[model samples]
Target: MIRLSNSVVLQDEELDITAIRAQGAGGQHVNKTSTAIHLRFNIQQSSLPEHYKARLLAATHHLITEDGVIIIKSQSYRSQQMNKDAAISRLVTLIRELTREEKNRKSTKPTRKSVERRLDNKNKHSIVKTLRSKVRRFFE
Candidate 1:
């Protein structure tokens, strides 16, 4: 079982892990060993709560596929076990992020003092600009 959080635990069977050979240049060892791991988690078919499932699917547009499967590929490590652990940890992290509730923003109008200060600044700026212009008098 993978424990995502205190409330969320994923059954081992829910996760599908595949071992594949790591790509790129790493000598004969990389070519011979299947150190990479591919993890696929079906969001729609999980035991997760309905709201959590909806939130996960909505938040992770890049990670979740159209079919509601989350595909995680981990090949950063040299050993297959390490790669498998990495993939599982990544999946847990993604769900953890979605579990956090977004703090609602409080709608507030500008304070009277601030609004007055802004107007005062605008008045000062206009004064400065007016001074920059040639002073015109009735003597013209």
Candidate 2:
């Protein structure tokens, strides 16, 4: 079982994992051994809560397909078991991120002191700029 949070846990049956050949340069061993792991989880068919499923389907992650299937490929590790573990962990992280509640931003007005300070600075800047103008002689 994969634990997402205190209340959410995913069963092993929910994930479809497969072993595939790892890409890139790794000598002859890379061509002979299948060290990569491919994990697929269907959000609609899974036993996850409605909110979790909704959040996952609504997510814009590249791993998630239009049909609500999350596909994760892990090939960084040398061993198949390690790659599988990495894929599962990544899936768990993605679900946790998607389902997590976001805190709403509270709008606040500027403090009186801050506003006063800003006005004071603007006034100082205006005075400095005004002083740079060419002086006129009343006699001329």
Candidate 3:
């Protein structure tokens, strides 16, 4: 089991890793060897909690495909083993991030003093702008 958090855990079989050719400057080694790792995890079919699955789907709509697969491409390292490890690490990190519960924001209203201060600041600003206007003689 892949432990995401204290309550969240994923099965090993859920992750699918495919070896692919890595791009970029690597001389002839990049073309000769398939070192890059393509990691896929099906979010919709996984054993994750409903709330977590919903949030994951909502938060990572770009990453998740129409088929509900989460694809992660890792080619940072040259070695296949390193790339595989990196992909798995990324998957764990992503899952961990999803599992962590966000702090509930408490609903708050502006204090009476704060509201009064804001009004006072607005009045002061208005007065400053009023002073910037051209003076006019009313008793002509």
Top candidate by TM-score:
2
The best candidate in terms of lDDT: 2
> Which lDDT tens digits does candidate 3 get at residues 64-140?
68777889999998899999989888888876676578899999999999999999999999999999999999999
lDDT at 90, model 1: 91
Q: Provide TM-scores for the models.
A: 0.87, 0.91, 0.79
**Candidate 1 residue lDDT tens string, 1-140:** 98877877899999989999888779757667899999999999999988889888787568789888999999998989999989999999888887678899999999999999999999999999999999688775
Where model 1 places Cα greater than 4 Å from the true spot, the runs are none
Each prediction's whole-model lDDT (CA): 0.89, 0.94, 0.86
lDDT of 1: 0.89
lDDT per residue for candidate 2 within 25-79, as digits (tens), equals 8976777899999999999999899999998898899999999999999999898
How would you order the candidates by lDDT, starting with the best? 2, 1, 3
The candidate with the higher TM-score, 2 or 3, is 2
Regions of model 3 farther than 4 Å from truth: 98-101, 138-140
- In candidate 1, the residue pairs with backbone N, CA or C atoms under 3 Å apart (3 or more residues apart, or in different chains) clash, namely none
Which is the winner by TM-score between candidate 1 and candidate 3? 1
